[model samples]
Structure formats: structure tokens, C-alpha cells
Target: MSTNSWDPWNYRSGSDFGTGHDLAGLSVQATDGHIGKVDEATYETGGSYLVVDTGPWIFGKKVLLPAAVVRSVDVEKKDIYVDLTKDQIKSSPKFEEGGTWSDTTHRDEVGTYYGQYDKGL
Candidate 1:
């Protein structure tokens, strides 16, 4: 498990949780909080900046976690978590069957909805 010093709900504005790291192959947790191993991550290509595969979390529901929405990462524990609640993730944008990432679509749907989350820092 990631052993980084992560404070509870540290994702609010002007908090240290916003400063995360590369998201490739990081562990993913489900809404019920079950640990789902990350299978893939799309970045810097095809407009997919932060596309990650939770395997089944996005089955018709592509829970796109914007760069800004991220809360923090525990490199030691090999985990990268977000700030959103279980319901939020479940209600986020939904992708196609066996689909990939798209920045334009995300910007229009997820980014526009989340706002300031697509601005890569």
C-alpha cells in the first residue's frame, strides 16, 4: 500500500493532495472500496491525458478522473487516489463498450462539468 503522508480529504483547494504524480499502473479502488488493480493508463496521446482502466468500474461508465480532480498519490504504496466520493465517481461520464480516451469529449462532458480539472499543471 502507498505509504505517503496523505491527510484525509486533502483534495480541497490549496491543499497538498493536488500535487500527484504519474498515474501509470497505479492501484484503483471501487465505489464499494474494493481494491481494483489498474490495468492501463492513457496519457499524452489521442487527447487522453489521464485515462485509466479500473477494469470494470467503467463498464458503460468511464469514471474519468480529471487532473485537477485528483487528490494525491502514495508512490510508496503504489497507489493513486482521488478526492471524489463514491457516488461522484459512479455518476461521472460513461464511455463506450471497450472504448478509449478522448480529450475533446472529456473536455465537453467531464472537463466542462468538473471545470479547471483539465488544466494540466
Candidate 2:
């Protein structure tokens, strides 16, 4: 673990996991089915998250998903599996693509939305 609280992207020490850059563009699937592809990712000391672009599936909506919900990553298939459903993600806190996301309020709202799931923080 890192002492830097603001470090966006958490990786276990001595692990072989790839960084956020490696996850971008990978398809993200919910428990039910495919939701979208990862537009970007942020890994904080608290946890990690993925910004997913829903494309035509959801009228080009973009959403933020907690890394805790992520069950697995298939590098060969370019896929990421999460334990949430499409509706759960659709109803989560809206994610704006600017500095507002860095706000503690926004982060808290997001955290609250997924509070039922393990944060893995």
C-alpha cells in the first residue's frame, strides 16, 4: 500500500496487475450483460473505478463504477466483469468528465451509491 492518499490507482504490492492504461478500451460487463467499454480509470488509495462509455447501448452515456464490483479481468478477451447490473449502474451517481469528480462530495455520493458492495478500500 502507498502512503500517498491522493494517488489515483491502487495496486497491491508485488502483484502482477496492470495499470489503468492497460484497462482502457476494454469491454465492461455487468452481471446481466455487457454495459460498455472503459473510457478511463482512476485508482485511488481508497479504491479503483472505471469510467465506462455506454455507446449506443445507453445513448452514449458514461458511468462510473467501483472497482470493488469488478470480479475479474480477462486480458485476452479484453473484458472486465463486475458484480453489478446494468440498472444499478444506470441509477448510480452521474459522472461528469471534469474536475468536479475530484470533489469529496461527489466521491461520497458515489461511495454511498455503492455502499452495499464491499469497497475494498
Candidate 3:
């Protein structure tokens, strides 16, 4: 993982994905398989993230994925790929609907969970 795991929370550099495009409704693929669709996306410099609506995969659960995990974006196919497994996303801190990103506590919790790969978790 990158030393600053949360840095550059946009689509990976040189992936040719447009930052201004609407990602909501696009399918999101995990390293293993399809996980959900992008319910929301942000391109904020260091706080970018994706709110994925898991539909029936996790009983309509939604997961917040840090943009750092985004490996690529396929606008043609309308798919977003992330460098993470379903289990990894499943194990992340539970995200409540209608939560705001301004909540630093929750964001910190999320950052901590995703950053654990560096510690060999």
C-alpha cells in the first residue's frame, strides 16, 4: 500500500478517467468480483471516496470506499475497479446512511481500517 494510504483520493493517475464525470449508477468491481454500484463519489483532494450501494449483495448495505483503492475507471463499460476484496470492504467500519463526510471520527475510523494493510493486517 502507499505510505500515505489516503493520499490522492481520485482515480489512479494516468487511468484517463474524467474527474468531473458522474460516477453514480456506474457499477463498481472489486478485485474479486462485482460488489455494487456507485451511489456517490467525491473528488476532494485528500478526502475522496465512493459510497457504493451494495443492493442485495449485502442486503442493501452501503460501503464507503476510499478513493485510494480505486485502481481504474472504465467509462466505456461504466465500471469502477478497486484494489480490494469483498471481504475487505465487508470488514470496513459500518457506514450509516445519510452520514456526512464532515464527521471526522467516522472518517478517521475508515482511514484506519483501510490503512491497516500497511501493517500486515
Clash count, one per candidate: 2, 3, 0
Which parts of model 3 are misplaced by more than 4 Å?
1-10, 118-121
Which structure among the candidates has the greatest TM-score?
3
Query: Could you tell me the lDDT of residue 114 within candidate 2?
Result: 67
Which candidate, 1 or 3, has the higher TM-score?
A: 3
Measured against the true structure, the TM-scores of the candidates, in listed sequence, are 0.55, 0.74, 0.84
Q: Per-residue error at 28 for model 1, in Å?
A: 3.3
Score each candidate by Cα lDDT. Answer: 0.49, 0.70, 0.78
Backbone clashes, candidate 2: 3
Worst 10 residues of 1 by lDDT: 1-10
Tens digits of per-residue lDDT, candidate 1, 1-121, equal 1233222211334423333355577775532463344444443322333455555554533356555555556677777665555665666677655555553554467655555223322
Q: Which ten residues in a row have the lowest lDDT in candidate 2?
A: 1-10
lDDT of 3 by residue, 45-118 (tens): 77788889999999988888877677788888999987788999888898665778546778778877877653
State how far residue 100 of model 1 sits from its true place (Å). 4.3
CA displacement after TM-score superposition, residue 90 of candidate 1 (Å): 1.1
In candidate 2, which residue pairs get closer than 3 Å at backbone N, Cα or C atoms, i.e. clash?
Answer: 8-43, 9-43, 9-44
Runs of candidate 2 exceeding 4 Å displacement? 1-16, 96-99, 119-121
